[model samples]
Target: MHDKTAAPENQHLSHRTAWLRAAVLGANDGLISTASLVVGVISAGGDAVLAGIAGVVGGAMSMAAGEYVSVSSQADTEKADIELERQHLANNPEYEVEELAQIYRERGLTQELSHQVAEQLMAHDALAAHTRDELGITDQLQARPTLAALSSFFAFLFGAVWPLLAAWLNVTFLFPHPLITIAVGTAIMLILLGGLAAKMGGASVTHGAIRVCLWGLLAMLATALTGRLFALVVG
Candidate 1:
């Protein structure tokens, strides 16, 4: 008697995991880069408001271009791979079936059952069966160029807004020396972003926060030194 109720547990879950990884990575990049940019600009003696606005605009455009190009390239490669797999399947169905059966056998299935499972899956949906079992490709996480680009761009811009707003508020009314205030605000914000990212990624929150703060400080220091050196030379 065939065990009709038995369903493969690992396959579908793996697809979800892949998509989560991509999304989390995208969001993390957005936060770190935007924060660093804003900090650098503020440290270079730019007015806090101007620095904030520039960071928002620059981060958004950079994210969009970067994400679009990267994900588009990945999507193209995936398309090519799929096309190749399709052609291979068409040209050599028997060999393809055997290959899938072999994969199942390698995964601890007996030869007879593996053959039966592969044949049954192929009969229902040859392309899907090959995509999953042979190519390890899943529909859920199939790269969408536009979606990835838009999400990255907007998330970066949104993430940048916090530090920008802190700078603006500090400069406008709260602080006599806006640079110091902005620096402090930005450091705190970086720590928060890092902690959030670490939590989501299942990492050490303190370590991530400290790492981000250190990088932001280094970038800001470099920019500040450059600005001072330029001023000295010009004067």
Candidate 2:
């Protein structure tokens, strides 16, 4: 027996998936990329705070622009698809209706029942019914270019702040060296960011945190090695 009294919460998770993905990905990129840049510069015997600042600002702006362009392109494609669907409905409504009803039938409704359901839905909102069922597009999940871009921009900025601040703190002064401090701070941010992202996505926090931290470790290590190599060449 289904408890109709239960709240239909989180139904919009799929709708939110787009923005959530953009935000989390942008922030994660910002954190890892900037932190790596700072560590790389330091390993190469450059100033830590200066390099970190440059990396943070550059990374944030780059992330914002990239997110804007990407989301805008997506929005354009979705808009074109919707327009085409509209035209198809105008030109071949009966065929479209049959298509929609068949989709419902395939979902286990009786043929007559499918037809009735489609008929009623189409009569009430033909375009909506067709777009949602046939094209798998819903108003709730419609692409919002501006929203995505803005979200990414700010999230990236937020992520970039952690590493930049950590680098500025000269935590290595308290530790063995700058590398240790920077790496430790970055690692903490990575794990925290990963867990936060996972929680938002309703996934396993440990898995998410571990996965992201591992990647961060590899990224930092690679940067450290590259910086050391470059330093030797320059030295």
RMSD values, in order shown? 5.0, 2.9
> Which pairs clash in model 2?
none
Alpha-carbon TM-score of each model against the true structure: 0.81, 0.87
Residue 58 of candidate 2: its Cα lDDT?
A: 80
Q: Please, what are the lDDT tens digits per residue for candidate 2 over residues 1-235?
A: 9899998966655445656765776889888988888888878988878888778778777777787788788778888988998999899989988999999999999999999999999999998888789888887777777776677778888888887887777744444577887788888888988997887777899999999999998998999999999999998
lDDT of model 2, residue 119:
92
lDDT against the true structure, per candidate, is 0.71, 0.83
| Residue pairs clashing, model 1 | none
* CA shift of 189, model 1, Å: 1.7
User: Model 2, residue 182: what's the lDDT?
Assistant: 72
